[model samples]
Target: MTLRRAWVAVAIAAVLAFPWAAGSYVNYVTCLALTYSLVTLSLNWVTGYAGQITLGQGGFFAVGAYLTAAAVVHAGWPLPAAILLSAVATGALGLLLGVPALRLQGHYLALATLFFSLAVPEAIMALPSLTGGANGINVPPSTTFFGLHLSNLRDAYYVLIALVTLVVLVDRTMLRSKLGRAFLAIRDSETAAASVGIPIEVYKVTAFTASGVIAGLAGGLYGSIAGYLNPATFDLWLSIYFFAALIVGGLGNVYGAVIGGILVVALPQLFSQAQNLANILYGAILVVVLLTLPGGVADWPRLSRAVRWLWHPR
Candidate 1:
């Protein structure tokens, strides 16, 4: 436990110093990665830990971004307030969706979510006067925190790091509690969990609500950092990417979410000149992981130990 704490401390310190270690563009990318990490973490909770297949994450993400953008641009709300309200609004929506969704399982649930993901952009395009329609909406820069103005990307990076740290801490704490155990039990076997009096439906909905809140928060941060929002940005492909990250990083692992988030954000930049090839490479990597590392990259340490033990049967 002490070693685990020390590793976390080191990771935190590295993140805190990242901007200084890299260029402005890198810092900006890091901020984006952190935002996606939050989204990945949200997905991990609902799909990974709770065994719910939701392809509608992109819908919730779009809702959060648009709501935040509208509130800040039109309602004249502060960024923090806009974010808070967006989270609540999205959480409510998640609960509404979950009530009907929890009845379905496997591919049925996945298709329902896929439809939700597809519907968001259509809804946005239909509501032009409010959502800015197909042209998209512009988000203002994050101006002040507690009356102190943040002037640049570096300042925003610091704020993002702090937010990510807080989120990770909260996630860690929650996963160590009975609630997390319940989520796992439900994921492993709904019948068994219910037989044990785990209140499966209640916990499932709670997981959805929690997932939506985190996704909403991520969307708010993405809007603030990107300073723009359009329907195209949160499309079905984005939802696929979220799931892909979860798979690559290892489902049901918080650290896996972080790794997946970084890869999702960074991979495109690495292959910006060959976008098609990048897509191919991404798909190939997923196939490889699925075939070789069924538990994803997070299980590498265990895999390594097994390999070493086999080679040197001590």
Candidate 2:
């Protein structure tokens, strides 16, 4: 086999065996990272490939979480069923939101999405009966199906691994498809894409819908793993962090989304004991990465080549 394929196989094997040796906390964080990766990847779908800026990811995240939680707690739906329903609902919401987005550009679109982020929490507050308001809502992770219980973090981790693998494949496939070309075209030059008969409006809406569906799925996974939902959890900073992580990990690529998604969550935890030190270190790291790689962590390939060139001088 080729070197790249062999490396990939080894990486997959290591990931599969990770939880076996890792502590509970480590496994839990990895699971959270996987969930956040979904959010970042979905954000990449709309903002990265489609060139549509969004500040409402947290809002859509809340929608997915709440819908899943409500279905499980109020409507007596199974966890899997609730997640499926939530995805569909969020996709519809994306389509509705996209209509207005068709008229917006740059900061105007950003503001509209920002408004959404601001509005979601308040709407939850208004519905204290269902949402539990500030207290949020909880659903124990003791979900059962076919006599098998999924109460362990390891179970969740494995499931996340599977989901991440599937999503990654889908991302790669879509990036090679006509739809992907259309989005990239629109991103580079909308007028040119339109001149070539590409439906800008339809594609824009499709991007939103696809992003929403993926974000909804992420929220569903998060809700299940977290066993709780709070408006405070889906705050404006959460939306902001999606962008931050995307930039840090790299943009317009799936691997970057995963790297950024995982790091954005994992980094704070790694330095949880020292807030000030963590802040300083994070700033330093960001500066170093920006100056050196510029393409974020996923740009290590270029970094490696530069290192090699320095040693060889040929």
Whole-model lDDT, model 1: 0.84
Q: If scored against the real structure, what TM-score would every candidate get?
A: 0.90, 0.90
Tens digits of per-residue lDDT, candidate 2, 113-171, equal: 99998999999989988888999998767764223333477888888788887887898
Residue-level lDDT tens digits of model 1 in 161-279: 77776877777788889998999999999999999999999988998898899899888777877887889998898888889999999898777787888888899889989978878
Model 2 CA deviation exceeding 4 Å by range:
2-6, 145-150, 274-291, 302-314
lDDT (C-alpha, whole model) for all candidates: 0.84, 0.83
Off-target runs (Cα >4 Å) in candidate 1 are 1-12, 145-151, 302-314
